[model samples]
Target: MSVEAKNLTFSYEKETVLRDLSIRVPEGEITVFIGANGCGKSTLLRTMARLIQPEKGAVLLSGKSISELKTKEIAKQLSILPQGPTAPEGLTVEQLVKQGRYPHQSWLKQWSPEDETMVENAMEAAAVTSFRNTPVDDLSGGQRQRAWIAMTLAQGADTLLLDEPTTYLDMAHQIDVLDLLHELNEQEGSTIVMVLHDINLACRYADHLVAMQGKSVFAQGRPEDIVTNDMVKQVFHMNCHIAADPIFDTPMVIPYGKGRKPYGAIAAAEAE
Candidate 1:
């Protein structure tokens, strides 16, 4: 396993977020965490990334405790893209990407050809090479997100953990960002773990899906195997039809409330 939490517990002061949760993120696959707001999907991800220490148990990276690893060692092994990442004002895309190489820098070598190569390759892989000179804050939401992804890519970590990568993006831009991540997972074999609110999109993208409920995993496995009507109702507390996505053959949720029912199946108020 690239990363796994062993009976981890965490709390935001008094209220517990993760309570004795344990799950292994499969290597070189896309694993998505799904849950309603404040259910601790993001909090679990934070523990996996070592951003917040667990109150009990441990997070193990490659079978070793993450807390025991050096900061640079951890940085070189895993990269994180937190939600709503921001760049300094007037920071060009290239400059931002270059920052990813900081962990590799030491008193011996300030910069190297390998660093430059990684930056270039990362920009190319993320398709943000054209925007290398553009200010990160000046680009569209999708482009800016890609630029930030490039920086994380430049870190050369085989593992990636992201929090709500598609937040604030339009449908098209959301697909664009997700497609980029999918490609990275498919082509580079990167171990990816993410927290996503859109269950349909998560089903489409995830190789392994973990559903959170009451601050613990409700179910986890292949989306097709674990995503059922009952799972949705319990995890999200909403009645939904579990339909296959026409394009991807993944589970698509048709929520049964507050929408126009053109077939006159049921009244909107009745669906509630």
Candidate 2:
């Protein structure tokens, strides 16, 4: 299923966060949103996920307005993991993951063998099976993140929306979480959309990239096609060189520091 925004406008109290932004998330692909802080990437993601209602436009899921869908129907097709999600103080990982089965259950069909199987598979996929009995508060940051992802997986939704899934994680943990999501997309053919602060990692993992600037999408395409030094300067307001990543061969951003001049600036100075 695909999610499309139609001239979405959103605000918080008196401040407008997103303005007339429209974008389509391709089905069965990983799409990453990248931009400077407060650039509306997260707001746009939230609006797409139906966590926030748009002030002016609508979000369509699989060609149907999400606002018109039943809540349980929407949950069966899409799952969202918001930034910094917290659980009850004493909730175990297993307990938390099982909660994802709520959408699949009704008064007449409370629990089924399929639910048990899904919960186990999700835990195994996220590599949190061993911590099933552990209190979520006891796990390290990365482990907790994985456990939360397992919960989302247990929802059995084809589309996953994550906002800054790597926040508060160390470098290795960041890659670990992102790699897990990549594997999920490759193996399950799921549509994964996420907001990422690390541009390099976004380029490395994203099959499609959306760069937001000034409350709208500045560019949208494959990272190799859309990410450039000029694009970086435009979105981030910084001087940078775009290079091919040695590992992933994707676009890598190398920023210029306050005391350093970009190679272009240096060359221009020498030409004077």
Candidate 3:
């Protein structure tokens, strides 16, 4: 299913964070939101997921306004993993994953063998079966993240929205989570949208990139088409040289900062 925001205008009390913004997330693709802090990336994601209503416009899920759908009806189509989700104390991984099946359950229709199979398959797909009986709090950072992802997978949603899925993870763990998301998009044709702080990694994994600046989208398109030096400068307030990655060939941003430059660059500057 596809999600589209139409002329959304939102605010945090008196201050407007997203103003007359619109975006249509391409189905079965990975769309990443990139911007500086407080640029409404997360806010936009929440609005699309129907977690919060926009003040002016509506969020459409597959051409229908989400305001008309029931909460469980929405949950069956989309799953959102908010930033830094916390499990209940002492909740086992399997138990936490079972919670995702709530939308599929009702007074007349109870849990079935299919739900059991789905829960198990989700645990296995997330590679968290080894710790199925373990408490969520006992797992490592990456493992905990995987366990939560398993819950979302169990929800049987075609679209997944993750807000900063890599937050607080080390370099290796960050890539680990993103790689899992990428695999889901490629293998299962799941539509994925996420807010990412790392622009280079965002470019590598995103089929579409939305660059936000001051409550508006600076640009939106394929990474190679829209990610430019001027976009980085205006959106992130940083001067960067955009080049293709050696491995993925996506746009690689090399920011000019306080790091020591190579001797060749220094000598070239002296020649000028």
Better of 1 and 2 by lDDT: 2
28-129 in candidate 2: lDDT tens per residue?
999999999999998888888788899999999889999999999999999999999999999999999999899999989989999999999999999999
RMSD of 2: 2.1
What digit string (tens of lDDT, one per residue) describes model 3 on residues 1-272?
A: 77999999999988999999999999999999999999999999999888898999989988999999999999999999999999999999999999999999999889999999999999988899999999999999999999999999999999999999999999999999999999899999999999999999999999999999989899999999999978998999886667789999999998874454434564465346
What would you estimate as the lDDT of candidate 2?
0.93
Please give the CA lDDT of all the candidate structures: 0.92, 0.93, 0.93
Model 1, which residues run further than 4 Å from truth? 258-272
Clash counts for the predictions, in order: 0, 0, 0
* Model 2: worst 10 consecutive residues (lDDT sum): 262-271
- Best-to-worst order by TM-score is 2, 3, 1
lDDT of 1 by residue, 174-241 (tens): 99999999999999999999999999999999999999999899999999999987999899888767
- What RMSD, rounded to one decimal, does every model reach? 2.8, 2.1, 2.2
**Residue pairs in clash, model 2:** none
Error of 3 at 246 (Å): 1.0
Q: How good is model 2 by TM-score?
A: 0.95
